[model samples]
Target chain A: MAAVQSDDPGLTPRSTMSWWFRREARIAPYLYISPFFLLFLVFGVFTVAFTAWVSLHDWHIFDTAAGGGTFVGLDNYARLLNDARFWRSATNTFSILLMSTIPQMLLALVLAELLNDRRLRGPHIFRSGLLIPNITSVVAITIVFQSLFGRHYGLINVALDFIGLDMVNWTSSRIGSHFAIATMVNWQWTGYNTLIFLAAMQSIPSDLIEAARVDGAGRIKRWWKITVPLLRPTILFATVLSVIGNFQLFAQPLLFAPGVGSMGGNDQQFLTILLYLYNMAFRQFQFGYASAIAWMLVLLTAVAALMVYAGVGYLNRRENRSALEVERMRERANARQEAGA
Target chain B: MTNVDAVKAQSAAGPTPGNERQAPTFKPNKRRFSWANNWHYLVLTVALFISVFPFYWMFVVGSNTNADVAQVPPRITPGPNFIENATNAMNAVPFLRSLLNTFIVAGTVTVSAVFFGTLAGFAFAKMQFRGNKALMAFVIATMMIPLQQLGLIPLYMLMDRFGWVGQLRAVIVPALVTGFAVFWMRQVIATSVHDELLEAGRVDGCATFGLFRHVVIPSVRSGAAVLGMFTFLFMWNDFLWPLVVLGGNQDAHTIQIALRNMSQTYYADYALVLAGTFMSLIPLIIVFVIFARQMIAGVMEGAVKG
Candidate 1:
């Protein structure tokens, strides 16, 4: 009986050496969750605080010596405000953001609506194919795009020539550079956005479309009225994400330029804010100014997010009010019919 | 059929043709041709072409010589110089070493994220602990702050302090547990794993750690797989962070850094650059092909919840 009891796994007595196992159970959750919090404290929270500290001082990149730099509070910010290159980068960031995001979102929405059709054959194939560009590394993407947009022998220019168009210098011209970079951005992201929008569209009730059709609404009208309104929240979400992502556009423009420089182009046409910050800290070794740029980018992203949030809030409220009005109209009609009876 | 009958019918219907037309519109007609159907196929085909054409072009360019690539109305077909171009690319940089380095970083990060993320996710999903709500909230909030922009300066400084500036661990250690991965795993665990099974494990004398190891981990293996795949892909494609940390340290460079180096070193050598790019992309393409469906589902799930 003793041997049988020992053989039973659950009935086996815990040795004194294994007492820590019982104690460990009580704090197991804490132990489980500690790694994330610990890492985040060091890498995420502390780093931001340190960036703020670094921005206040005139810290050079290699100034590792103790007490090496003097503090000049807000000096970096002040200099940034007056910096022409900084302003140009800011404009370039916004231009690229708008150029890439707007069309990408619209195209994604349309594609999602189309793909939402149940009768569409082999949609899984299309969906998987769409994600190919996204899975490709940005480095590979940039190299391929550089060759495609090359001035002399690029496939794009070659095709343009086939169509009797001039061979536009993709790298030298500002609009041309922005357009090429935006094309890369769109090509990579449009599929991702499509999948997101498709998820949203899938959640929308089929009965709603059937009801609209029964009410004599055309397909387009149903999409515009029922589908688009229902997907407004998702649209807002995707837009905010795109805004945040586009502000930090880096690799495409970095490789798109004629030479391997962070200037983005000869005339600084595609110099995004993040690339600019990278250039300052790594290339120019201005850690303090780069920290300032990082903070400014954070601020810009926050403001953009806030603007979209407010816009979405207002739109939601208006939609609610209009829906309420329609409900009130139905209630009044029912009351009038009862009164007549 | 008379004017009088038509007038009476229109008056009774309250001047609305919708009721009269609703039945035919709402009926399921099997043989009816749909313009919308044709439009959908057309759009999907176009979008698919746009997505896949660049990759196809990469193969074409990579397989051709420089002269062939630079031809007017550039060659659309693959040529016979694929091996030659690939050889030239390998000679230009430490391609295999960089690939190994990238695999190391990505593999370590993926394993760490999966293991640690699963632990935290299981805790958040199942166990009631002190500061759990606040901690989960903190994790979610961390997802909003872009890591590269805010952390680069201080992180670089930290790496310098640690003498790990050019080490693979500099990238791997920091990316071990991402906020998004933790949140995603939590969501997966909360929805999929049940309290009853955990209670059963407890009754069987399974400790908390044992419950997680034996019950929770197995149950959420699919979610962990998704998280691992995404983390691997993100780390493999990562550029800005590695570029900064491993700057000018070609020996420690990842595949992306190597590709960047090749692009510059082989400037105007389109075939070699394309070959390098193609080689760097092959692993991701293979992984994507194998896990395409699961990946699509994972992305959609993340989007919907996130």
Candidate 2:
């Protein structure tokens, strides 16, 4: 702001009330936005950087008493890289992420499409009912699911026995454990995504669909051609969100078993990367190596997110570009008619 | 027929013309939507059934003995032992205390995050300031970092130094103002609050803050409400940090930690474990039930784009 102080009493150096007001106006926004930056720096950014530094040291979780940990150069990182357990956890994380997320996205989309009907009146029940699972704490849902997926006497096993089918040991076996954990993740999240997609679908002007209907487009064709194309942004949003959230999958896997220090399983079948970090830091008291694992998680999440963005972005643009071609043809026809006139 | 006769016919069809979803402008025939020929409700029914089944099963198993849950048919009904199991569950772990503690922390975090988010969001959306874009970018960057995981060890030590370990403040302070909250509110403000309104507020010599309080707040009330609901849900369900910092404080645990402790301690006591889990779900279930409509509309606000 320009300082236009004058001989006037309000603007004068002795009584700079008006000048102060102008200055305040100029500076108030920074004041408003500072809280997030301040808190995030102290808590979020600083802590992340601190984790990296800690990874370079020989730090025990409880070694804060006697002048803290010793500075060991790069040993923790080396151990983390060469460790089979870390690789297992990383592989488990990605596998669960894919298994859970792909089915999740498809199911949420299909459910959203079904609920997007204009004739579906007073759907608050369905919408809210679907969201109940999402609202439940991961701890609660994982435990409940673990029960249903129980081996011998569990309800699922009983059902399978009644049908003369083989019952699966959910937690003990690798595929069974991953499937059970994924189901817990899916049940919790699908409803919330449905609402998000419903919102996105609602905004896709109905007349566009009506236009396609009039043009003799089949039901599935119209949906694939028009609705899917318009829903690009929301699809990308949900995909990227799932990438970030499920990649850092911790709570469900942590609480999937019954024991205190279970580590996903005896053989670490369902051990997520974050769960491994927790086990390392808390259970084993290896804070330095745990911090290294944490850094690796950040890198993996970043890579997954970028890949989703690029891949989804390309898919969206490819189809939307076709629509743009049709628009260009129409515009060319209109231009020719105007020239003749 | 006269206009009066037309109105009479409409009234007879439905007691009130207000019952009609849309006014008959272009389409002469007012088509009433029926459930017939629509298989969508079938999909919805199955979906709702799946969604509700887990909780129902939780209730059933929770109200029965471990042996009853193990019965051949698999007990699917709520039993009379719920209150008894609840008492045992409470005694075993700090369920009730954790519920109260979770409420306090989640409530405080929601209020502070919303207020700060609105202030910052309004500034970024409507008001001009130096380094505005840079600061906004910084906030967005913060969202991408799984800072909870990234900063886990350091934060543990930090909380210990501040004498906040085993205290609610350790969990509460770190999450006082989140990046997503700021970004969400900014989207709400940018899309919903119009420039003409802000200009009018400015013409009346309203300060920047006044413009936000008067013009922006009223317009973004629904968005604010939605953000509050989301914030509360996330904070309520937050497990990792609360588990870490408050690990030592068994009595001051959040419901998630309490549930974890209960299920592990009474590992074979499925009834007791499930009872604790069911108790923890009660608050959020109630919130979801009551605010269903508003929450739906709020998600429809389109934070992804706006």
Candidate 3:
């Protein structure tokens, strides 16, 4: 075979070519994967650049910016920084993130714990069921959730009334509407997070837990001192995802908000940064301003992600130091015992 | 990694009962259920119910008539009007035409993605290539850049300029080169395909492409099938781009768009909307039901290995 000849090094002179052949062999995988990078270069990098370029000008979707505006340098960014609407959208994004992601992660951890239980029957069924919401069409989910959250005649209100509570205008008021959106998000995503956590949990060694139990630690004590601390990486990953996804919260709010064609709810209650940008560029035709806003959002999310990464890294380093200190004390004890002997 | 492992081991040790103190106590070694273990079944049951209830409601609503669905207390019963509702859905929307369009778009995209994806994947995995490490890293990292974050306007513009807007090619062509599919295929091919097999084919006078055709393709068929299914589902269920590109173009509207339009206009027609929604879901459910094992295997395999 060609592989055998190449190994033996007793083949023809042409086969023995060294510099060029070796270099080509080294680079072949790169050649194979080039299409993705090529597309990314053209479509991905260029798109962001074009958006930034457009943002610098008074770009409009329909009419030319020359009709009413000029290329005001840093004006859009300055205006956005001072804009109440931008701040309100940012607030809405964070509020929804808090309302949804915190509980979602907690619930996921609980579910993952449950799944890891040996007594649980048909765990696969439950796991697959969790993924159902993830697989369903977003459009379909939004529409279904809209009806379910409707104030007057929705099933949610009906259930509320049965429990002797007044009907809540879920999609009208800012706080109420946010709760509705958050619930939808939580319902759809909790299972997904649970599965990810479960995967993380399953990778935990049995011997560690056995040792902890042998040390006379109760289940709750072990979980707090063991599982929670250990699942940090998975938690960090999920949290970052939640943050990014919350920023781009569009379709649900766009659909759930009661008004006919509004991007956000009444008073711009649920308008996330991405939704605001979408409305500005596509709806209001403020393409330039929208581009600036979009770029700002990208920068904000990146910074937030980095902050989380650094914070987690610092905490982990501290934990590692304490662990190493314990090991040092144990080594000192062993040395003293040897000296005494 | 060591800390993570240590913590995992601690949790896996489970809980020792108070009976652990007395070795002569009745079954002293019996494990005590941790609060987590005690609550596990309860939590799982609650999660399962919540998860499955919506789909259960969808199916329940599908069987009911429009009037029944709108009634004061929503009927939990299955009505005899599912057939009538389905007929109405077909008449109101160009259901058959849209289905055909979906099939063509998803089919072409899936087939092309699998074929090209496997070729590229195989080349990356098996062949000696230049710049393989950097190129593969680039391919893998592309998943982090949100697609909608980039290329929304220009992608639309590109399609518009090419006169591919509202054409099935608009969906198919872009989808045919997914980074994920290529990565997946590369992995599957690397594990399944043998260098020995390819060398044997070369020794028997097979050309590079011929070796791929005769040997590699057959070996990676299951991987291709799984990837093809995912490609199909993604295209079929896509809404935003389809909505933008096919705006108000009835002839080119996808099922998702049609369903959205129907729900928005016929807001009170819960039964009809639910029926339409269920109809859209049937293909996915059927596909999953048939290939559940393979799909689950693929996902679990990725999780363990990755």
Candidate 4:
């Protein structure tokens, strides 16, 4: 009976097939990971394509004019490229980025250095203190900042006045408004960057610093020669993140700046690209045009990121070359000294 | 080799003479207390005050009437009108429903996120399944995809088709399995959970589910707690999705939606709005303190490698 069962083709097929399935069980992991990709394809990829398509057509949500969407190819792109509002928003975005990210990263690095000092106690408390702004809801922080920046009885201006400065028309003036918004953004983000930088700094070996110190290097020299060079990767990472974040600046600026739903100020000074896109899409119902702007923004961001990558790479290569030269010279000098001795 | 040693020898001798430089054994000095050590403390203390002062000031403003709040130089002290302001805010919107809705949505998201995130994490980390590497890479790449601006419209449409519009699940359900939680859980599991233990359970005839529950779940309890807390926090403070879907339905609003509506319509009522805002922060602050360790660890863990 056993021999007959073993010789049966049906049983043989079933057993070998099951073994193959078991051997190819790696497919289950793909299945496990497929849900995100599937959702992203439908929700992310398709929508992006649809948005681009819609941007090309002059379509209304209500479809009032001739069943909606006259296929006027490239006109939207032409207009968006030439649009003053688009240029203005891009300028505002960069301006705010400069105002917020530059000082923010610098201050964060200094704070991180202090935190990294061996003598400093209760690093946890300092770490927690740095995280408050990160964890606070953007809404709550915006509302509070709005109240504090109020022109008449605002706490910030009042404090400024107490220090012999004029009561700045923070929201009414374009630059003032941008600065106000930038201040809030910096406050909310500096701590986050500090934590990141601090973590990066901690990973740097203390032995390097000790070696530098033994070589008679001062704090400043050590920072420049060892710390800054080693932290370049972290800086590049933080910068790219900051760039992306700056382009997507919405909530705080939207709240702090005048004009409902982010028209920027009276002068459109703080109207970010995202805010402009939002207005175009939702407020004006120009889905097609908004999509073009979004795609353009993405392209621009990618280009900017690529440029930074190239610059960082070039600088690193140059530094490495010079460092190698220095090593070679030092080695030759050591050989001569050893031969003379 | 001689050349290399000579170079090293020269470099070592370049500073402080070899004997002085080699005195790495120890340098003992009297522990003189300097203000520099306390300087960091002072700076951090000031930052902490700035961080906490705004919330305290919100309470102070909340207790005052509108006139009192608008007074020049600002009222630094609390007034006696907190009850009136709170009552006005409560009456303005269905605050209780919002609280309940927020809690339920956050709770559901937390539970689902922890369960799915943990399961997916374990599978990716431990299972000897095919395509594991590709799946892990896909999950990591999803973190870089800027979903906020990119996926908003399509996601909204999806929710619409599913008839989840104006429902809290519209926000909660899609977020149950995200790139962040999945990656985090996987990392935690890889470090904490051992493969041998799972094998041992299997050898003992433990079913897959039984192995997960009895062996895997207990091991990753702390990781799950951290994920759960953050999931709850994000849901609680989520503005745009709920704002878009539930804009017209005041009864279906969360605290943020209700608060935004109040502020949008009644920006002049600084006292009442501040009261509502202050009330909104209470639950989060309380939760944060209760889960302080996990919260801190979660932030550190996420930032450490990144």
Candidate 5:
């Protein structure tokens, strides 16, 4: 890979010395890029693979035997399938996921459309304000939300009392506790998703909207017909991200039901998969079972992502086919007119 | 503001040459006093209020005493017991130690991420090395795999094996480089650093690393600054991994852990809990305010191109 030496009178003697420099230059990029690979391999790839291997054994955190725990292939997986708490955690995770994701996406879409209006002044203020919740630590959010959802003197309870409604114990009932946690999730993430949607909306061609308006389409109709379809890719992307995030929900519920010690509440009402995995590994010292739970979550996240990806792809294909047909029909009309003329 | 300017410039330039005649006929209806015109602003105002109100309420509660906080209407204004409550918050746990520990961890992570992310990003963007494309794809693919979910147990085991289970390095070292940061820096370097500048540097007898130090780093300073800010904020606010790794180790607790500890200890003391919560959030808010534009742009850019 060395370049040919030039015929300059002063360069002839130094050419041999410059060979090392040239070689170094050729390999410098790899040196520069090695840190990340090394770190990722140690912390990321190795850990993931090791966790998989650990899941196949009957390992415990404090199993202080001379050798590693005995091999018990698929026992942890079989146990996970039959565990009622596992099923309960899975249900809680999906329930919270649906509750949080659906409203968050819809509200974010509406908020993004509103903020996309060019006539709005100081839109950045609102946009930045929305991110405040996102930037705050989850521990702080959970603490503040716990006080807000407090049964006795919470501001929410006081507001309910003002409306002649009984104070609901937000931490006791399963649905109530789930709703409380989901509210925090929604509060923290809706603004973030709104900004994402707003970015996607901003990238849409304005001429398309103007054309729809010229055709007498109202504002909402223009959004529904033109903007939404163009934003399908971004929406799908955001949905997949939300699914991955929500399924792995942890700190909010953990802190929300602090006294319960990972049961989430008295009846284990809002025990998310991640929290359950955490309790299993750290609390119960069942490292192998927790690894199994982690793998199951990974599988669930993959399946959710795949389903959304497939659904979006199918819709996009159908839309493209119809659009192609419309173009063909327009071409035929143009050809007919040209022939007649 | 730049986005606004771009939109204005595009509109001022009107449609493409062929479509110029039809552009004026479909000039999007001008501002009118209708629900459509005002409703969006109203909605945005409400959203802004919802977004900011919790922090405001936290501040109010933090400043009040238990008695003042329990009042029916709740103390809407800052009460005079701020110092008392803050002292209680500090006394509840090693709050100051946690803050210092968090800063050390976050600062180290940010510095390392910026340095290494910039280095690797420049290499991937500008250099033609073996397996560059595949390596870059691998980095991007790593972003999709959430580290906490899959790697927690093994990572903990590894840390235990290395005798690092309760140390700040357990959190800081693992976060020293991130896939997102590398991807971000790569995008910025590719767009911002022109090839001619590097060629000029090379012609002037600058070495490869020298060219990177002088040409690439200076060119991508703003991008690096944004990355640094994000890294710091993420490290500061990170919960799960640190929570797992640092578990119950009071000496190694970060600000988040300290805050959780305070809340659990002072579960009955709303004022104390709120004070600790507010204290932990102060740095983030200040950072957010100072770098709001850059942070917003960073998030939007990542979403659009990711």
Candidate 6:
């Protein structure tokens, strides 16, 4: 045993200096990653805890009161639960999130499929073009979109008029406002998501598709049976990412709802949670109340993200696109083709 | 210090030719577009047009007179008023200064994020220390925090206390380190830097830092550059936080803030504002032109590999 122990390079008994050197090699990783943890502790972990703590108090930035404000012990949270604007804003957030995310994700998958075409010409140009909107400031895009979605003589309205359609009040009405703002979010993100999906799609081994084709499957059939299932993990990851980002939905709605005091609309029609939080903290100086809203927003975002995970799981069960099911689908497809022939 | 000198000398010596080594082979596309692939190209072209038309429209409105912008058909073609509108935009807002401020913020943020992210990414990828998995998961878990929106109040207070309020540092520092960049670099380094290479470095008496500086840095150069591109774009385009912190300090306003100033007007000068928007897109457009290939490869790598 002693001979074996000495034979092992790492465990060999050596001088204290050698042992210390070995110890550092193990601990050096901590030194490497400490900066992130330090910042995470202060800026990330500490801020979250502090935000929660602040939400429990009656803190006001201007009052400069002692002890930062009285401890309300869930009073702020209680108020938030009853706040009408909060509910309205919550609904708006959810609706806009759905409106933006679903279409954007669908469009991205389609575009990615197109971009992943092996024989596509100038493919690099198209990929880069798609990402331009993402790289351009989201705020800047919102500003441009705000102009484009103008009430009259705006590009969209003019386009609508030319198409023999009535131009809806984009900034004034609820659905109109949500649709316009959602369009901005959709346009800005779809391309980036397309690239992500494209990358994932490209990595899907050609053997899988070729095998499906050899099994007498058409292109669309092969894609549905094989590619879609394989891309599920990447899709879920992309969805969670979009949910986290879209839930914030601040600058777009704020800038889009022009002349409405940045309340998302005159009636707060499309007011998101973050915008509402901004108003509560910055406009009303209700830091405590705003913190509560923020806390709730985070929780809801987490719930939404987790629900996506579970929802996809539920979809798997309901769709039941197991290999057996796919085989059945392929057999049905082949039968139809034979009958048609 | 000696490690730094050694790296300088080694890199100055340049890469050693390795014609003997087996490299991964790729079949290059030698075929151009054929008639059968016309529809695919057409679809991509249409998508490309829609993707890029917004910038074109921005230019159209920017270079045109406001009267031309308000026309029924709207001026689809570029007008000759670009110089005038640009002059108006520059005069109306401190755009030049704000542009300079944006460069500083984005530049500093990119450098810091890339450097620190590369360092930590190397450690995470190669190191076999305790709690590596959990710490990495923790890093990833924090990505969902949405720091800009959630921590607004406390961050403001912290900045206020630190006397960084309305200073560019307020924008630069908090953004210097992000969970995404760290996580991204981690993935990049993990896949790109092979274990055998690090083993070789270690056998050559390279310490942990030495391995990182030499073996890791060169191997992960493209990844670092990609991370830097993303970080730069993110920092350059950052809005809400800078708007909140730099609200009081116009001297420190970023391009986004300046553009916001033009955008939030009562009458809304479409020509001037769009001109400002047009101006802001130029730098990024230039960057895209230069690094589009690298950026595309970078995106694919991060997505597919990770």
Q: In order, what DockQ does each candidate have? A: 0.54, 0.47, 0.31, 0.24, 0.47, 0.32
lDDT tens digits by residue: candidate 2, A1-341: 33343223343454354555467688989899889888877887778888988899899976776666889989998988899999998888888888889999889988888888766776888888887787788888888988888887788888898999999888888888888888988998899888888888888766566655545566667677777767878888888888888877887787777773368899999898989898899889988889988888889888998998899778867767858844554466556658879
Q: Which stretches of candidate 1 lie over 4 Å from their true place?
A: A1-25, A321-341, B1-37
lDDT of each: 0.84, 0.82, 0.72, 0.73, 0.84, 0.81
- Cα RMSD, each candidate: 6.1, 7.0, 7.0, 7.9, 6.3, 11.9
Chain B superposition TM-score per model: 0.88, 0.84, 0.83, 0.86, 0.87, 0.85
A202-238 in candidate 6: lDDT tens per residue? Answer: 8887756654665666656666667778788888988
Clashes in model 2: which pairs?
Answer: none
Off by over 4 Å in 5: A1-14, A318-341, B1-36
Cα misplacement distance, residue B226 of candidate 3 (Å): 3.4
TM-score of 4: 0.85
Which CAPRI tier for candidate 6? Answer: acceptable
Interface RMSD of predicted model 2: 3.5
Question: How well does candidate 6 score on lDDT at residue B94?
Answer: 87
Clashes of 4: 3
Chain A TM-scores of all predicted models: 0.88, 0.86, 0.84, 0.85, 0.88, 0.87
What are the runs in model 6 whose C-alpha is more than 4 Å off? A1-20, A63-65, A211-218, A327-341, B1-37
Q: After superposition, how far is residue B269 of candidate 4 from its true place, in Å?
A: 2.5
Candidate 5 on B1-306: residue-level lDDT in tens?
354554454456554322334545645423212332355677888899988889888988999888888988777898887788889899899999999999999999999999999999989999988899999999999999978889999999888888888999999888888888788899999999999999997766566787888999899999999999989988998888888889668899999888877787778899988987898888998899999999899889889886
Docking class of 4: acceptable
- Candidate 5 clashes: the total is 0
Model 4 per-residue lDDT tens digits across residues B12-93: 4342222233434323211322232244566767766776677888888889987877766678899999999988988887
